[model samples]
Target: MLKILPAKEIYLQGNEHAVLLLHSFTSHTRDMKKVATSLHAQGYTCYAPLYRGHGHTPEQLLHYQVDDWWQDVVDAHQFLLNEGYQKISVIGLSIGGIFTLKLAQFEKLSQIIVLSVPIDKEPAQLKQRIIDYAYNYKTIEGKSASQISQEMEPFHHMALDAMSAFQQFIQATMQQLDRITVPIAIYYGERDDASYAQSAETIYQHVHSSTKQKRGFENAKHLMTLGRDQDEIIQEIIDFLE
Candidate 1:
């Protein structure tokens, strides 16, 4: 396991109902901290696993496949099952949200909350954008490129091979969306640049869930959990889970 700095993995024991939080691609478990904490406070056991090849250097990420990350979630699910949690809900961000949808196909989940899931988008283009941003790392305020990259390393950049694996996962996940049968709460940022605004509607229209809800934030971006209206988003998740 890669030692993730600043924010380590979280596993808080609570009630029989458990919430599995998955962080975005290239993002560490820290990004899921607020959501996990909120769920844990509600007397629910919360487990946020650090996906394989994530929470480490970009170079390290290139060495792992997308299946490894998905298997990480599978392992976490089995762990929760072994712990005797009867109910399991999943909440994820971006690629994490995509993975959540994929897992819902096989796991008997209670509910799923997808935040800024990227559908109807080209993964290759997104990968190129990341490369562009990295090669042309800009100085923010007064911070140099090196300083900025260091500060944002945990959540930025994807190696070429990793991006290819990500694209494969995205394609397979999209094709299998109709397999989801549990209640779903889909949230997307209206002004999201990483994921198009229409992707949320596409998911809502395609999902087989009879109990589905959608929320759009006009001012928020892709990282809904870390955005300004995060409290509102978290409340929406909690309300949906109930």
Candidate 2:
């Protein structure tokens, strides 16, 4: 029998300060594991929740709305709060970044870190891309069909309705960006495959946070958390949180 891989939540209990790290769309908590580990090393409690419809199949994502994902963050935040964590921060990657920004609108967070978020997205085009991918089951942009299939084997196909939900989430998040008052930090790569560095720069310029910073890595790609500057990125995050 083949060994089945489990999709488990990542949690580390440490100090009173808690950090919630969120993964990308179609990704599980594993994507944020390294960040959680680094934070744990710094004596910060960390939690990475598996969003609804994630960690199982990609097709399951189609059944979930942007609101469902946002609720996951809310529940995770509440979990920390229930554990007596008063000072909480968040780090979100890709669609997770969008959820983080949306969370800022409703929560009094200590800080916010956005990684590879799309601030200049063309929603219709993105939706169409998702539709095309679902229709053809094509290879991903940077991966072969087998590689893509292996990576997404646990997940189901992407659906058009889910893409529409994502578009709505993007619009909603953009509208609330100016309301974010916490100290904000954005990380981006100059050659990010999903979003441009200008999106990070744009967020730094627009968010109402008086203490905001933007960092760009010339060699890093979209997945900065797992890239060449991973250590540097973690150190920067630790420093910012401290």
Candidate 3:
């Protein structure tokens, strides 16, 4: 067995400044743990919530849609407000970054930080990525090769409606990028796909924020938060947030 641990939400109490940390698609709250703990250490309260269809089986994930996950984002933000924190910042990765941008359009946030988010359009490999995630998830669950093959059969020919919804969601968010006016910092990994770099530039140019910045980590990849330069990235985030 791979000993894959269960994922849970992380909530660390610190000062009046609260940071909402959002994870990527098909990812867990644990992916944001290092960043959350580091922020907490710097006297910032942090909360990383596991989205509705995440931290569970891939099949179960397919059961939920983008709107459902968006609801999770809204609930997470409301949770912080209910805690009496007037100053709330957001740090989001990949899909979470999309949610961050969408939230910025409707909410008054202290600031925003997005890592490796796709902004131009729907990624060409979106469906393939989902298939890969399904395979890897089954492997982690201790399924044999044959069993995995059998289980993933349906996904290979799965409906495109779900994928279409995601594409529509991305397009919708991109259309509203100009509505985001909060101070924003965008980071992408140089080693990742070329599209991410383009996405970073697209976001920087479109957002109406007076204070906005974009940077690329030389040694980091798609998952920058858990990459080799994670510590450096965290320091940069701290600097920006401060």
Descending-lDDT candidate ranking: 3, 1, 2
Model 3 whole-model lDDT (C-alpha atoms): 0.91
Candidate 3 at 21: error in angstroms?
A: 0.4
Q: Residue-wise lDDT of candidate 3 within 1-242, one digit each (tens)?
A: 66666689999999999999999988889779999999999999999999986887778776787789899999999999999999999999999999999999999999999999987444446667778889998887888999999999877886777777888998899999999999999999999999999999999999999999999999999999999999999999999999
TM for every model, in the order presented, reads 0.84, 0.84, 0.96
lDDT of each residue in 1-242, candidate 1, tens digit only:
22324446899999899999999876788878999889889888999999876665444554666788888989998999999988999998987898899999998999999989887445576566454443343332345666766755543545456666678788888888899889999998877873556778888988999999988987778788898888888888888888
User: Taking the tens digit of each residue's C-alpha lDDT, what string does model 2 give over 1-242?
Assistant: 22325478899999989999999766678879999998998899999999887765335555676678888889999999999999999999988898899899889999999999986455556555444444344342345666766656433444455556678778778877899999988998776864557778778877999999999878778777888888888888888887
For model 2, state the Cα shift of residue 236 in Å.
0.9
Candidate 3 segments exceeding 4 Å error? 1-3, 120-124
Q: How far is candidate 3 from the true structure (C-alpha RMSD, Å)?
A: 1.4
Say which candidate scores most in lDDT. 3
Q: Give the whole-model CA lDDT for all candidates, comma-separated.
A: 0.80, 0.79, 0.91
Deviation of model 3 at 44, angstroms: 0.6
